[model samples]
Target: MTYTTRADFMSGLREALGRNNIPDARDILIDFDQHFDGGAAAGESEADVCAKLGDVDEIVKQYISETDGRFTEAQKETPVQETVITDNEPEKNMNTGDFAQTAKEASAPEIKNERSGPSAGGIVGVIFMDIFLFSWTLITLLSLIISLYAVTIAFAASGIAIFVGAIMIAAVGAAGFISTGFAPISLIFCGIMMCAFGGMLVIASIAATRGFINLIIAVINLNARRFTGHNVCRKIGRKYREERD
Candidate 1:
C-alpha cells in the first residue's frame, strides 16, 4: 500500500518484515528513520521522501530474500540430526565452503554498485563543475550569509546605541544640563521600539543563515553525486539535521 508519512511507511515495513521473519529488522528500521530525517533536513516533504523510497511491499520482499536466504543457508550448515553427525568431516568442510561461497555470491552485487572510474564526459563535467559552477555558487552563498549576519549585528548595535542614548538623555534632562528638543519619555519609547525590531531581525537572520547553509550543502552534494557517482548526500543531510536538533 502507498505510504505518505514516515510513521506509516515505517510501521508497514516493520509489519511486513515481521511477517516475513526478516532478521536485523531493527537495523533496517533505523536506516529508514535516518533516511526520513535526512530528507526532512533537506527541505523535502515526508511524501516526497516516501515516494523516493518506493513501495513498502517491494522493500520487504527485498529484505526477506536477502535475509531469509542467509538464514536458510545457516540452518542447512547446522547438524540437526544425530545421523548427520556421522557424516565424514570432509562433508562438513564442504558445507562450510558452500555457505561461504553463497555469502560471497550474495555480496557481489553490492560491490559492483560502488562508485567506479568516471568516463571521459564525466571527467569534463567534473572539471567544469569544480572550476566554475561549484566555486561561484559557494562564494555567492557565503557572501549572502555574511551579509545577513552583518545586517543582524548592525541592527543589534543600533538598538543598543539608541537605548543607551535615550537613557543618557533622560539623565541629562533630569539634571537640567541642556534643553533637549524631544521629550525624554518619547526618546525612551523609540529606543525600546528599535530594540524590539532588532530582536525580531536577529531571529530572521539566524533562520536565513541556516537555510542558505543547507542550500549550499545540497548543491555541493548534487555536484558530487553527478560527477563522482558518490551518494554521500543523504549521510551529510542526516549529520546536518542531527547537529541542528
Candidate 2:
C-alpha cells in the first residue's frame, strides 16, 4: 500500500475502534501499520490489502471481541489482592481514612475558587463574544436560505417563459404555413426545430426547478430536525448514500 492510502485506512480504523471504546486502540493501530507495511513489502495494492482485512466495522467488532476475551482471561488468571489487616491495625486504618477525607475537603475550596475569580469585564467580554457568534451564524444561515429561494424562483420563471415561447413559435409556424399556401418546406422545418429547441429548454428548466425544490425541502427538513434537537440528518445521509451506492 502507498503511504497515503495506508494512512487513510489506518485513520478510519482507528476512529471506528475509538468510537466503539475498544481497549488498546493504539496497539491495534500499530499492528495494522505493520500489516500494511507487510502488504506493501509483498507488492499488493491498497485495495487488495484492505479487502483481505475486511471492512472497518468488521475489524472493530473483532477487536472488541478480542479485547473482551483478553479481559476475561486476565480476570480469571489474576489473583485478587486483599488487604490483610491484623486486629491491631484497625485504629491506623481509621486514622488514615480520616486524614484522606480531611485533605480532600481542604482542597475542595481552592478548586472551587480557581475559576470563580473572573472579573466583571471578563464576564461581559464572554457574553459579548457569545452574542456576536450567535448573530453571525444567524445571518449566514438566513443569507443561504434567501439565495436558494432566489435561484429556485429564477429557474421556475425561466421554465414558464420557455414554455410560452415554444407556444408562440408553434403559432407562428402554423400562420406562416397558411399564408404561404404551405409552399416553403424549409420554413416549416425551421419553425418545428425552433419549437423543439424551446420545448427542450422548458423541460430542462423544469427539471432544474424540481431539483431546486427538492434541495429546499431537504434544507427545511434539516433545519426543522435541528430545531427539534434531533440529529437525524447524518443517519439519513448515510442511509441515502447506502441506498445510492
Candidate 3:
C-alpha cells in the first residue's frame, strides 16, 4: 500500500505483465505510474489507492485488453530471443510455447516491447537462410565437378580435332594432284565443321571455369559469415531495441 520506490512499482508490474515482453512494457509501466500518481493526488489513502486499482495481475489483464495495449513494430523486433543451441542435445525443434514463453519473459512491468508485431528472430527467416546455405553448398560442389568434366572433355576433343584437321588437309592436297576438285571441296567443308566444333568445346570449357570460380566464392563467403554475420546482426538488433524503448 505504501507508494514506495520505482523498484516496488516495477516488481508489481513484472508480476502483471510477465518477465518476457516486448519493449512496449516500459510504456505501459509509465502509464501505470501516471495513473497511480493521479489517483493518490485525488485525496485517497495510499492503501486505498492500491486496493482500488486492484492486484497487478488484474491491471495487466486490463492493460492487455486494450486495442493498442502495447508494443510497436520497432519494439517487437527481437525484444527477447536467445539462440538456444542444444550441443547435440536431442536436436529438438522449437514449439509454440517456446516463443510464447520468451515473449512473456521479455516483457517487464518497468518496460516491455508489446508491439505484437512479427517475431524478431522469425523462424521463417531462419528456415529460409538454412535452405539457401544448404542449396548453395550442394550447387557449388556439383558445379565444381561439372567444370572439371567439361575441361577434360574439351581437351580430349581438341586432340581429336587437330588429328582430323591434319588428315583433311592431306586428303585435299592429294585430290588437287589427281585433278579432281570434288574431294578438295568436301575436305574444306569438313575442316570448317571440325573447327567450329572445337571452338564450341573451348567456349564450354571456359564457361565451366567461370562457374567453378563462382562456386569457390560462395564457399568462401559462407566460411567468413560466422564472424561478419554475427556482428552485423547484433548491431542491427541493438538499433531496433533502442527504437522500441
Candidate 4:
C-alpha cells in the first residue's frame, strides 16, 4: 500500500511484523520511527521517506529471513543430542582416544569468510582520476561560471550608467549647456537593448551554474563510491527515480 504519512507507514509496518510473528517487532518499529524522524529533520516528506524504504511487506520478509538465518546458525552451533538410559546397559566412560579427539576438535582453528574491499590499485586509479581529470574539469567550470556572473553584473551596470548618461545629456542639451553630438533617443534605445541582453545572460548564467553544481556533486559522489565501495548516491538516485516514476 502507498503510505502518505508517517502514521500510516508505521502502522502498516507494525501490522506486518505482528502478522509475521516477529519477536523483536517493537525494536524494529523503533528503528523505523527514528528513520522517519531523521528524514523529517532533513526536510523530507513522509511520502518520500516511505518510498525510500520501499514496500512494508518486502521489509518484513527481509527481517523474517534474517531472523530465520540467525536461528538456523544458532541451531547448527548447538546441535542437540538425545541420551537414552536403560537398566540393561552400563555407563560408558571416556577413553584416552576419545578425550584426545575431543581436545583436537576443540583446538582446531576456525576459518572465517571475510569480505575484501577495493584493491590498492583500484584506489590508486580512483585517486588519479579525481586529481588529474575531475578536479581540473570542475575548477575550469567553476571559473567559467564566476566569469559569466561577473560579465552579467558588468553588463547590467553599464546599461544603467549609459541610460542615465543619455538622460543627463538630453537635459543639458535642452538647457544649452552642452552640445549633444548623437541623438539621445538612439542612446536610450541602445541602453535598453544592453539591459535586455544582460537579463538574458543572467538567466543563462543561473542555468549554467546549477548544471555545474550538479556535475561537481556527481563527480564527487562517483569518486567517493569508487574509494569506499558503497554507492550511496547511486542508491539515493535510484530510489528517487523509482518514486518519481
CA lDDT of each prediction against the hidden true structure: 0.59, 0.48, 0.47, 0.61
lDDT of 2 at 147: 65
Sort by lDDT, best first.
4, 1, 2, 3
Per-residue lDDT of candidate 1, residues 1-245 (tens digit): 76998777876776666566565554466578778879999999999999999998999877756665776644444322211221112122222222222222222223224324445765676567668766776678678778877877777777778778888987897788987767766767777777787788888877766555555544554456445765343322233233111
Rank the models by TM-score, top first.
Answer: 4, 1, 3, 2
Model 1 lDDT, residue 194, Cα:
73
> What local lDDT does model 1 show for residue 207?
71
Clashing pairs in 2: none
lDDT tens readout by residue for model 4, 59-165: 98898787764544433443211111111111121111222222222221110001024557757776777798777877897898999999999998888888998
Tens digits of per-residue lDDT for model 3 on 1-245? Answer: 23344445545665445444434554455555556568768966556666666666656666556645467666556333222222111112112223322333233322222222334443354345547764675577577667766666765566566557656766766876545446545655565666576677667666655544443443333333332331111111122233222
Candidate 3 segments whose C-alpha is farther than 4 A from its true place: 1-181, 228-245
Cand. 3 TM to true fold: 0.29
Query: On a 0 to 100 scale, what is the lDDT of residue 159 in model 3?
Result: 54
Q: Write the per-residue lDDT of candidate 2 for residues 1-245, one digit (tens) a residue.
A: 22235545765775675566565454455567667778989999877888788778878777767666564543433221112122112222232232222222222223223324545554454446437653464456557656655655565555555556555556766876435344345444555555565566556555544444443343333333333422222212222232111
Which regions in candidate 1 have their CA more than 4 angstroms from the true location? 1-120, 179-182, 223-228, 231-245
